[model samples]
Target: QTYKFRLYPNKKQEEQLLWTLEKCRLVYNDMLAGLNKEEKPNRLKLQSMLPELKKQYPELKGVYSKVLQYEVYKLFSNLKGLGELKKKGRKVGRLRFKGKGWFKTFTYNQSGFKLIDTNKRLKSLHLSKIGDNISIRVHRKIDGNIKQITIKKHCSGKWYANMVTERNNKKHDKKISSVIGIDKGIKYFLTDTEGRRIENSQFLKNSLKKLRREQRRLSRKKKKSSNYNKQRIKVARVHEQITNHRIDFLHKLSRSYIDNYDMIAVENLNIKNLVRNHHLARSISDVSWSAFDNMLSYKAENANKTVVRVDPKGTSQEYKYGRDLDRDYNASLNILERGLASLPQGLRKVTPVEIEPLQKLETISASLIIETGSLFQNHK
Candidate 1:
């Protein structure tokens, strides 16, 4: 995970966020002006200049706002790169300066960060302006120090607190005793070489009917009415529940693979092209193949395992029932059943590494011309 820890922000916390954001915005604007004048815009000097700035620009309104000492500078440091505003340079999403309302948002530095506290081996988190008794859940014990903290508010209006830490990297081996090829399809989420068929959870499919019903219920209520707002939240919570279920399923499934397999080989799906097919697009998203594979990688890395991605061009098509390739794709998914059928019983936990030339795999016969995709993009 990129970061850890949950933020518990109350009403008072919300005010503080707005305050900090506003001040950070001012800091960035002044710096930009200083740079234009060939003046140094250092943080230390900026701290000292705040009083004079407030004195000169009374309209900037100094006395009414909360003082800066209450919050630390590390957590919500001024936006630097794209944050500094690119000239013409096109960008998506609205770019707005941090306003006074953002002071409740806290910044963190390598210092404001801290060790995670566990019920087992004790560790503590230290906040610069705050106390050290912040409670955090320790899932994996590791050697590390907190690097930074970022607290954000999600689109769903929920507060999230993240603690970025420097942790040790894990190591795993390249296991090649066995190889399994997986084909992810719309009908079935996955069909593996071992004949372990995983059914599609189809969370979106299952939730649509109920979602539409709730949506209609929401529409019936008057706009801007209290009842409408209340019903909207209810509808949102339902969708959230379905998403939670899918996320949990992906996490568990990926973990199971990490714990059991030393290597996992999967097709690189071109999501862009796949989504163009309206008929199967919804089904493809429901399975969330990309997310599953991504989670599998880091989790496997942590366990000292490997993830082998083979060219997926002819995986399903090359092996028609009862047919053999004139020249087998360097490795064919269809023939996977034939290839591993003779493996020892105790050797199911490991898989082949990415040791073969992908060009060799690309030479196999495909039912149709396969376009360049994510799989090709990742080829070594």
Candidate 2:
């Protein structure tokens, strides 16, 4: 598990943090440069050269040594992954050197980082070479052994610390009971087997007016000027707000489902290919179906529940009782049926009630219709 916190570094400490970021970026670029020249790049060989680099470039010595080492390891890890992809006949791109503003995060592996005042509400982080007691907002309790610390700087001029931790897996013994299948759409974020719906937040679209105003203001500013930089940060913060809100909503919704249900079935959407439809790309991206499914998978696993990804083909096209069912409702029923069939007979508890035909269903509330869209998608 990884817990992220808002970091509050003093002016001097913030300066040191920025300096460390720059040093790490330089080291990343230099390592990539060396790897490009060599026919065969070795991780350990590149790591061994760190001491020599610190001696040559005295600036690097000021930064934590382990942070620099992780940069080299990160490069090699990427390269190794690419090689594996190539072996599987996938087109792989070469590792590129980091340009200015490209690298935003640096990790301290194994050591050089500590959490202070755990008992207190407001805690602080201590890094070996940087400083002592860097104030951080611990919004939630972190329940694990922290394995690594990653400091990241956002374009919004905010600093964050991601604490990677390993926790003892508590296998949940809760008996499998309730099950659900969800169909995701642009209108409602999700429609479940039981006809319950959650409206899409549409965070990006809601913030678009402010975002465009900020971008327009930014574009008018002279490039590289103080005003331009300030405006750029403003623009970044608008996007950041949309992202944070969207993520928060997805987390909460996914967690609620994971907690309540023993099994969750969702469509296996290939979002990468789906987004290529230029007309639907914006709505699809805003909905973030893939992200929701991802959250459900991990959360369900942690709770010893199950998440099944059924093939999305023909789900929307399915019908019942000699008439076309509501698009998402039909898809959800298909999903739920497929999920239950795949599971062992004993585990397929609480079968879903047959949904009434679209014509006979009760009137949907005006507020709900305006909040989302009409329940039924136009069936051509």
Candidate 3:
């Protein structure tokens, strides 16, 4: 598990952080230069040169030694990922050198960072090279043994500490009795088997105008000018706000469904394929279906609930009994049917009336009942 906390650094500490960032960036660029020259560029090999580097350039001594080593490890990790992607037919590119401000975060894989007074209401973070007394906001409690800490400087000029911890595996004991199906869409965030519709937050769409204005101002400023750098931060914060809002919405919605439903069935959307349509790509990306699915899987696992994915083909095109219905609702019904089909006979007892019809101007309750009943009859 990982928890993020806001870090409040004093002026001296902030300068120390900036100096460390610059040294790490230098190391990264040097490694990239070696790689570009077809050198071995191994992490161990690169790390052994750090002592010589610090000796030659005293500025490198400002950063912790382990933090510098981690930069070497990170470069290799990224290279490995790129190689794997290329194997899978992706268009791969060579690793590039880090420009100023491009390398925003650095990690302490196992040492140089610790927590002070964790049991108390207020806690502080200690960095080995940087001074202690860097105030940390423990907004929420976290558990598990800390394994690594990453320091990130956001373009908004805010700092954050991300701690990666190891926790004992949780055994799920919740008994699930209720089930629900969900259909994802751009029009509505999601439509469920109970005919509940979650409205799309559209964080990006709502903030695009402000983002565009800031971005335009940024482009107009002379590069590297004081105003340009300040405007750049403004643009970054706007983008960050959109991202944070979307993530918050996804987390809450996924948690609510996981807590309430025993089993969750959803369409298996091929998002990569769907996004190929240029016209719908922006809208599809905005919905972030992949991120939602990932949250559902992890949350459901911890809650001892089931998440079943069903084939989406023709789900929105036709109802089971050939009655017309809302596409999203119809998709949800099909998902439930497919999900229940795999359960044990004793647990699979959901009936037609339990699934509600989508809202409509003219009532179709009678036809809905007959259509649902006929669906089971035909299947049985």
Number of the top-ranking candidate, with TM-score as the measure: 2
Give me the runs in candidate 3 sitting further than 4 Å from their true place.
38-41, 118-122, 172-175, 342-380
RMSD of each: 10.4, 4.8, 7.3
**C-alpha TM-score for every candidate:** 0.62, 0.89, 0.85
Candidate 2 colliding pairs: none
Query: What lDDT does each candidate get?
Result: 0.54, 0.82, 0.79
lDDT of 1 by residue, 1-380 (tens): 45544544456655555444565556545544543453433555555565676676554452222234223133124324444455557473433443443433445645544554555433455444444544444455444665666655543455556766676875434434545556666555665544444557688888999989999999999987999878887787778777767776777656655665555677666887988999878888877889988888877666766565655676655534434422233234443443343344454443233323222222211111112222212222
In the range 226-257, model 3's lDDT, one tens digit per residue, is 99989988998998888887777777667767
TM-score of 3: 0.85
Candidate 2, residue 5: lDDT: 93
Which parts of model 1 have CA positions greater than 4 angstroms off?
3-5, 18-109, 115-126, 129-143, 155-157, 170-175, 220-229, 320-380
Clashes of 1: 22
1-380: candidate 2 lDDT, tens digit per residue: 77889998999999998888889989998889889888999999999999888888998888888899999999999999999999999998888877777789999999998888867767879998899989999998787789998999999999999998887887855545788788888877887776676677688888999999999999999999999999999999999999887777777667767777899888888998999999999999998888888888888877789998888898887775344567777788888877767776666555544433343323233234333333332210
Q: Which of the predicted structures, 1 or 3, would earn the higher TM-score when compared with the native?
A: 3
- Whose lDDT is higher: candidate 2's or candidate 3's? 2
By lDDT, the candidates rank as 2, 3, 1
